[model samples]
Target: MRETPSTPAPRPIVGMVGAGQLARMGWQAAISLDIGLVCLGSAGDAAARAGAPLMEGSGRDGAALARLAAGSQVLTFEHELVDLAALGRLEAQGVVARPSAAVLSLAADKLRQRRTLDTLTGVEVPAFTPVTSIGELEEFAAAHGWPLVLKARSGGYDGRGVWICDDGRAAGQAFAEAAAAGLELYAEQAIDLAGEAAVLVARSPSGEVAVYPAVSTYQRDGMCRWVTLPASLPDGLDKKIGRLARTLAEETQLEGLMAVELFLTREGGLLVNELALRTHNTGHIHTEAAVTSQFEQHLRAVLDLPLGLTSPVVPAAAMVNIVGPADGSDPATRLAAALAVPGAHVHLYGKGARPGRKLGHVTVCAQTSEEALALAQEAADRLEGNG
Candidate 1:
């Protein structure tokens, strides 16, 4: 008699820390892959709103992390603000945290990331120095020139924890504020920026890698507002940026998605600005524009599965962030109007409206970047009651 075959084991679950918009999108991708996503989010987070299974605690809590780990095969993150040392301990205890605690720690500290990348060949970073006190900031400014940029080495994002000081008095104020907040500060020479661009790359634990095209990012008030795919770069610049992203991924031993934000200097050279080790706002357009969305690619990478093609299905695509209006009215009230824009794809993070808060995003794909941008921006504006 022939022996009967046993049933296959269920797909492994991915435990994502911080159930923000990125985690919500990742959970959607997990659904299509027949995998599970256990989100360690607080009450009413985007992922929780999306009905993902919740671990229901702060990501910084060690016990919550352990519980999440116990029920999942892989641990990942939607945000990098976790307690790295505790996560490192979890890794020691056999939890598979893709991108690793070591990588997360390095990326979490801007000073460390800057120093490490500065030493890498073919990587250009703006001159930067650690600033511990007002005097140190002054000293760096004296050397680098006034109007320098000061950034907190940790806990800075979306324009917070960053300051521009044109004189000693301003530097002193910034230093005092940072000191009171217990933040590590660093000074950087502000580059004459032509524009900002970013490349999203995914690397699997098995050493497979895929890279998306570099995209132009437009910032307003230090937060990303719009991003256009196939950033108009000088000839050969795209390939050069692609190589840089791949090199960084290999050097970092990245096990999931990494977004390399680069500065296109006025001097016609590319400089590294920052690195994000998870899904990022820069790749938001990939959801409707590319063959494989960044969220899906991240899941595949973390699972050590075959990476997906990173090609654009359309000639051009653009993403526009929907910031909360000044009056703080809910954009959801205008959701129907936004959805009416032809070829526009809208994604709203389940959150209450607040001034300048990232409430959602709209993406549009078309034959030209100009058309995509116009449509995406129009749709985003409608969502915020600006159109």
Candidate 2:
């Protein structure tokens, strides 16, 4: 009888901090690669609910971070709200973290990112100033005009920690609130936006990079509502955006993925809006539309594996977010009805429903952008009881 060989042990685990929907998606990707994905997140996080291998801890806790690093060959983040100093300490101890703390720090601070982008050629960011008091805000507004945008330098997302001050009185009120909260603040000139778009790029430590096509995004009350893949832009504009994204990835020496948001001005120019250093909401459509999804690409990049093709398999794709309905009904309650929509690919985040909260999303791919958008919108509306 021939001797039987035992199966080899599984590949090294990739630890992710923050087990939200992004980490949950990463978990799914890891399964395909036959690797482990251990999430360091609160017990109640979406990934935990989805039965991911969870470490059950706060990302800010150094001990918890060390515990996660101990069990994994490499560490990456699902969110940028991590404790960078702690991550640095882990690096010193020889724990590998892709998009190292130095790179992640730039994304964690808005002011730092703004300053860095302002120095790069062909990059245009809004006129901004770090404001320490109401006087500084008034001065900025005086120079840049009224209706200025105020943002916390850190810890802001999904329409929170941002204020629009139309006058000195409003600026003063916003400044006072920020000061009370002990938040660093900055004032920016509000641009006349024709629309918004984003580019997702993945880079490996060996410097191999892949960039996805730019996608048009629609925002409602500062939260993304939908995205149309292969954004309809004038000839040559998409190439320019793709180049900018590649330049950013190379300049940052990025490992893993970066999503660059841009504001398309009414004057036909693009301005850098924000930077996200992990899987982003705008790239959700890629899961169903692209030849290789962003989540999988990110894992490959972080592991220094060959990057996958970034082209879309379909002609057009649209993704519509399922924000909780005003009545606060769960999307799960209507899951069957949503699934009934032809060609609809629904993804529920396993989050409790609350007004304006993101519960899930729907993506539809078709031969035309209009058809994809219509189908995705209908499916999302039906899930939210709006259809």
Candidate 3:
């Protein structure tokens, strides 16, 4: 009699710290791959609302990180604000954390990231100086010129923790506010931008890498409003973006996905804006446009599995974020109208309405970038009751 075949090994579990919108989307990808994705966050988190399994814990707590690492083959993150000391301790215990604490540091602290990237040749980071006092802010401004931006060194996102100071008085006030809030701050030269763009890079433990197209991003009040891949760029910028992203993945020894935000200067030069060591708002367009979604690619990378193809299936794909209007109307109530837009793929995060909050997003694909973004914007307008 022939011997019985044994059952195949289960795929490695990815324990994500932070069960917000990023993990909620990642959970959907895990469902399709039939893999386990456990998230650490509050019971009322977005992944919780989506019905994914969750363990109540703080990502910055050493015990909590250890707990998440115990049952997980590899630990990952959906946010960059976790305590580096706690993660370092967890890693010392033989627990694997993809995009290790070192990589996470490159994202957690703006000052640190700026210094680190400046050391890399061909990577240009805007001139900046760590500011802990009004004197330092004024000094940097005097040197870098007026119209600088004051940024929190850590814990800033979606326009918060950022202040544009056109003169000395405004800079003083912003610095005082950040100081009163007990935030470490820095001042960076406000770049003159012809356009804004970003790239998504996935690098597996085996060193296999995949880079997505350089996608154009539009920001309002410092929050990304819309994004479109195949951004019209100066000759050879796209290819240059791919090479730079690949270099970042390899040089950093990344074992998971990273979103590299870039600034397209008015002089036709590229500057590294920021880095997110997890799924980013800009990469959400890949869910509808690429052969493989960014979430799935993230999982594959952290699991050390062969990466998925990232080629675009459509000529152009654009996404518009569903921001809560001033009236605070729930986008879900307008779902019918948004869905009625031809070729619009709408996703609503399970969250209540609040003015200026990101409640959901809409993606559309078309033969041209303009048409794709126009349709996506139209659908988003309907969702926001603007249309």
Can you tell me which runs of candidate 2 are displaced by over 4 Å? 1-5
For all predictions, the C-alpha RMSD in Å is 2.6, 1.3, 2.2
Across 70-93, the per-residue lDDT of candidate 1 in tens digits comes to 999899999887878888899998
- What is model 1's C-alpha RMSD? 2.6
List of clashing residue pairs for candidate 3: none
110-150 in candidate 3: lDDT tens per residue? 88999989999888989998987788888898899989999
Residue 114 in candidate 2 has what lDDT?
A: 98
**Model 2 lDDT per residue over 1-387, tens place:** 998998988787899999999999899888899888999997789998999999989778889999999999899999888889999999998999988999999889999999999999989999999999778888888899988999999999987888988888888888888899999999999888888999999999999999999999999878999999879776788999999999999999999999999999888888999999999999999999998899999899999999999999999999999999999999889989989999999999999899999989999999998999999999999999998
* Full-model lDDT, candidate 1: 0.91
Clashing pairs in 2: none
lDDT of every predicted structure (CA atoms): 0.91, 0.92, 0.92
Compared with the true structure, the alpha-carbon lDDT of candidate 2 equals: 0.92
